[model samples]
Target: MSKSVNRVQKALEDLKLDATIQHMPESTRTAEDAATACKCSVGQIVKSMIFEGAETGKLKLLLVSGKHTVDLEQAAEVFGEPLIRADPKRVRSETGFAIGGVAPLGHLSATDTWMDTALLDHDLVWAAAGAPNAVFSLPPQELKDATASRIFQIG
Candidate 1:
């Protein structure tokens, strides 16, 4: 395995998750790509998105369903204001990975991760694993624990 894949595998292993990181034969940067490769509903693909908090205005990761968009009004009710899409520089500084390749876990810091409650509806979900061409399968709860995320109505 490549060092990048190894790091992601190590992190998932450390969490004791029953998941294996697999390199996609094609680009797996988008949730649609992952869904196509995994042959699952786009809704079953968990997209870990980076956003800037409007309050502290810091960058954070939000794991949402591929089938929907983050309801900003609802997010604001909890977070105090609309969130902004995080830029590339801040994404790398915070998550230690580029935007298109960011994983749901293994960030430089926790950065207030929020897992979309919509994900809990699926028995399994796919997440990017350190690189755009890599992915992994796991139950939603494992991702929540791995990322230290709180469950929220993100969609």
Candidate 2:
């Protein structure tokens, strides 16, 4: 396994989660692709997005459902400041994963995390496992707990 994928696997183990990372021949980089590869509804895919607080330059993680997009204005209110897209380089450096495979857990640096309430509607959701083609499935509540994410309507 690649180091990126291994890191995510170790994270799952640390959480005492039995979720298994699956390496698909096809890319699971995009939410649509992941849902297709996992044979699930598009809404069941977790999109791990990173944003920067414009004022503080602090990174924030958002675990949103595939079917919705984050509203920057609302997010700014939730974050207590304006938000900007985090640079890809900074995201990788801080989270230890690239844009297409940023997982909800196992970050190199801790960031404030929030999960979209939409994800809780699903029993199982798939998240990228630190590689474009790697992913794992777990209960939505387990994911919320593992990441210590504050649940909110992110989109």
Candidate 3:
């Protein structure tokens, strides 16, 4: 297994989650790609976005349904600061993953995470597992609980 895959597996094991990580021969780097690979709807893929808090300069994570987009204005209202997209270097330093495969959990640094309420509509959701070709499936609620993510209504 690659280092990225191992990190994801270790994170799952540490969390006591039984979900298995699957490696795709093709890249599952984007929502469309992952959804197609998993044979699921676009909305069932979790897009983990990382941002930097403009005020605090801290890393923040947003887990949203693949079919949805996060409203930065609404997020600013909730966080009391504008969110800036983290650079690839910053993303990897904090999350242990690159732009195309940032997972919702197992960060190298502590990160504040929020989840889109829309994801709860799905029974099963797929998310990146620390690499472009690695993915994992879990119940939406279980994923939320595992990450201790607060619920937010994303656009």
Worst 10 residues of 2 by lDDT: 71-80
lDDT of candidate model 1 versus the reference:
0.82
For residue 86, give model 1's deviation from the true position in Å: 1.4
Show model 1 residue runs off by greater than 4 Å: 1-4
Model 3 scores what on Cα lDDT? 0.89
| C-alpha lDDT (0 to 100) for residue 140 of candidate 2 | 97
| Angstrom error at residue 73, model 2 | 2.7
Q: Write the per-residue lDDT of candidate 2 for residues 38-65, one digit (tens) a residue.
A: 9999999999999999999999999999
Model 2 Cα shift for residue 140 (angstroms): 0.6
In model 3, residue pairs whose N, Cα or C atoms come closer than 3 Å (at least 3 residues apart or on different chains), thus clashing, are: none
Could you tell me the TM-score of candidate 1? 0.90
Of candidate 3, the 10-residue stretch with the lowest lDDT total is: 71-80
| Residue pairs in candidate 1 whose N, alpha carbon or C atoms collide under 3 angstroms | none
Clashes of each: 0, 0, 0
| Model 3 per-residue lDDT tens digits across residues 1-155 | 77777888998999899799998889999899999999999999999999889889988899989999877777788777899888899898778888998999878877898898999999899999988989999999989999999998864
| Model 3 ranges off by over 4 Å | none
